[model samples]
Target: MNLDNILYWFNEVFSSLIFIYMLFVILVYSLMLVFAFLQLRKDRNLDKNLEGKVNLNAVYSKPVSIIVPAYNEEIGIISTVQSLLTLEYPQYEIVIVNDGSKDSTLQTVIDVFQMEPVFRTVQNQLPSAEIRGIYQSKLHYNIVLVDKENGGKADALNAGINVSRFPYFCSIDGDSILSTKSLLQVMKPIVSSNGKVIAAGGSVRIANGSEIEYGSVLKSVVPNNPIVVMQIIEYLRAFYMGRIGLSRFNLLLIISGAFSVFSKEYTIKVGGYNKNTIGEDMELVVRLHNYLLKNKIKKSIEFIPDPVCWTEAPDNLKDLKTQRRRWHQGLLSSLMLNRGMLLNPKYKQIGLISVPYFVFIELIGPIVELLGYIYVILSFVIGNIYLESALTLFVLFLIYSTVISMFSILLEAWSMGTYPRIRDSVKLLLYSLSEVFWFRPLMVVFRLQGFWYFIRGKNDWGSLTRSGLQKKTNDTL
Candidate 1:
């Protein structure tokens, strides 16, 4: 065959493959939408029944040790600590791991909380960086701080784990603030499961434009920044549509590290967080799944939709890029490390459904989608595309992006009633509709950069500047 014929054949094959992949993705997403709707409805009804029925401070509830790993988080650490102090739970201790931040993060906590040095012995169950000293807050006897050498987040978490004294442990990022009842709500599934659920994650909301008073979100307002507004919609889609459905089937692969509770015994048995990977949260969760399948253990990891942890979202382009790249890198690291469980029969639904979904749909989906975009441009330039078919696919992709995102926002408004303001809801809907044209593509580029960085062996946790979430009047810290 001539060169023209060969080129034509290659283009045809590529177009066919892209179409098939797009169809597969759309079908899967549609199924997820159904599953998510059902799960959300069920959860809402259950919440109604359980309202005022169970006491969160009951004797049967297990005590939790809240571990916060702080590194260069002086801006928000005080607010985080204050929030933990006000948790509605009956019995819990707060362990803050100071990961040798160059700033005055440790000193600020020490001075504000009136912390005094103490010699507390740790069991050293997990390997971690050297500990310089440990301090207990004079104001709050249960609040402890571990000043440690400059270790990464994972190592810091391991140090916290070593110092923690409880059957269950909860990890929260230094810049995050949990709702007063977040701990109670997140622990509900674990308590109801009778210890069969080893880990549980709560929903994380964007706190960019929200009013914060001593770590609690006073009034949740949609940010005017288009980037932040888009992120709010993104969070809604991820938590309401993706996680809830995944958790319903006991196939949850990741519990967000921003706010998650784990069984101390099980985490220690699985060797704690992997210090080498940037995605320690995801890696640890996957490892837990692997260990359970290998040992034929009957336990689960869950995602609770009501428990809300408000976190700061990237508002600018540069910061957003860095965050997305790091997240994608972490995801790739987790999936690659657990590649053996991709289709293994012993792992059941996890290996068969979740692994394949992450590998094909989550990991490679970006590359395929990018290629499709390029193909569209080339086809239009060459004037060889079928207009009708192209238009249909384009509409489908738009629906996948805008419509689904809008649905998620609507679901949140209907069930959770997060954004009480009708204006905020309308603004969120408008931003979701525009996400496909700009924000989504930009994220794809950032994620692709992350993939490239991973391949080039670049290990850097990009800088993140936090505008501390504290009301001006309440900024005493």
Candidate 2:
């Protein structure tokens, strides 16, 4: 056949595939709307029952060891630790693993927390390179610190796991801050599950420009920067809509690195986090499910909607691109590492459904989207104006993205009422519109770069220059 004939056939095939994928996308959004609505109702009912007595002290009375793996976080380590110490939880220990930072991270923490070096024996069996020393807080009996060699984030977490003296361990980013009650709320289902809950993940809010006092958020005014505001909306959609449906099906692939709790025994049993992978958080979660399925164990890994942890988001293009690239690499690493489970009947929903969906839609989504865009643009440039076909394609995409974003907004308004101000809601709405046109394309490009980079064996961990969370001290309010 001639080139023209081949081009015509390719266009026809691509058109059909795009339409089918768009349908699936629409259906996913539709189901998400239903799930978010249901979750919103459940949240409202729970809120009514715990009105005045909804403090972390009342709900989560269990002992928890909060593990913070820090590399070079000198700028915010003191503030983050101070915030953790002030959390209203009755029983919890703070473990900070200093992963061989050349900066003043260790000294800063030691000086701030009044640290005294303590002799603790922890077996470094997880293929970690080395450990320099371990320190315990002189001021707080519950706070411990480990200064280790330059192992990765996964390595640092494993080091923490080995030393943690609690049944449940909460993993949080060094730069993130948890609400006092976030631990209490996240621990409720774990403790109340009668030993059935294996893992629980919480929602993470952006703290780019929010007014954060000590460790608590006094008010959540939108950021002055457009990038930060867009991220705020993105988080809302991801947590409120995307996770609700995924959790209901027991096919959640990721629990945010900002805040997630896991039963220490189960986590240790799964051989800890995968050190070689960039997406260790997700890899661990998937591995948990894989273990449950493989060993015929009945356990629950859940997403708790109410518990909130706030973290800094990238406000500039360079930082945002680096973050997204790492995210994409992590996703691919998780999927590929667990590729054996794909379509394996033993893993059931995770294997047959979730894994395949993520592989198709998420891991490789950007490439497909970019190609589709190219094909459509070529068609428009060429005189082959399939007017009805183009219109259908555009409408389908617009409706799906808009509907998912809208449903997430509605869920936020109904469930937590976080975006209370009318202007914030309106900004989110404006953001939703901008997402399809502006943000989505940029994301696709960044993600495509990630995929290609990964394929080319470029897996270096890029450092994100933190803009830092907006401290209340800086705000006039």
Give lDDT per model, in order: 0.87, 0.81
- Per-residue lDDT over 68-151 for candidate 2, one digit per residue giving the tens place of the 0 to 100 score: 999999877776777788776778989999999978999988998889988987855445647788898888989999899988
- Model 1 TM-score relative to the real fold: 0.96
Per-residue lDDT over 1-477 for candidate 1, one digit per residue giving the tens place of the 0 to 100 score: 998888778877877788888888878877777888888788777754255247564524699999999999999999999989888888999999999999999999999999999988898999999999999999999999999998799999999999988899999999999988898888887887788999999999988888888878888888788888899999998899889888889888988999999999999999999998899999999999999999999999999898899998887999999998998898898898899999988899999999998889888877987887777666666665444445656676787788889989998998898889999999989888788788888888988987998898786878887888866322111
Which residue pairs clash in candidate 1?
none
Best by TM-score: 1
List the candidate 1 regions with Cα displacement exceeding 4 Å: 2-4, 47-61, 384-386, 472-477
Q: What's each prediction's TM-score? A: 0.96, 0.94
How much is 298 displaced in model 2, in angstroms?
Answer: 0.4
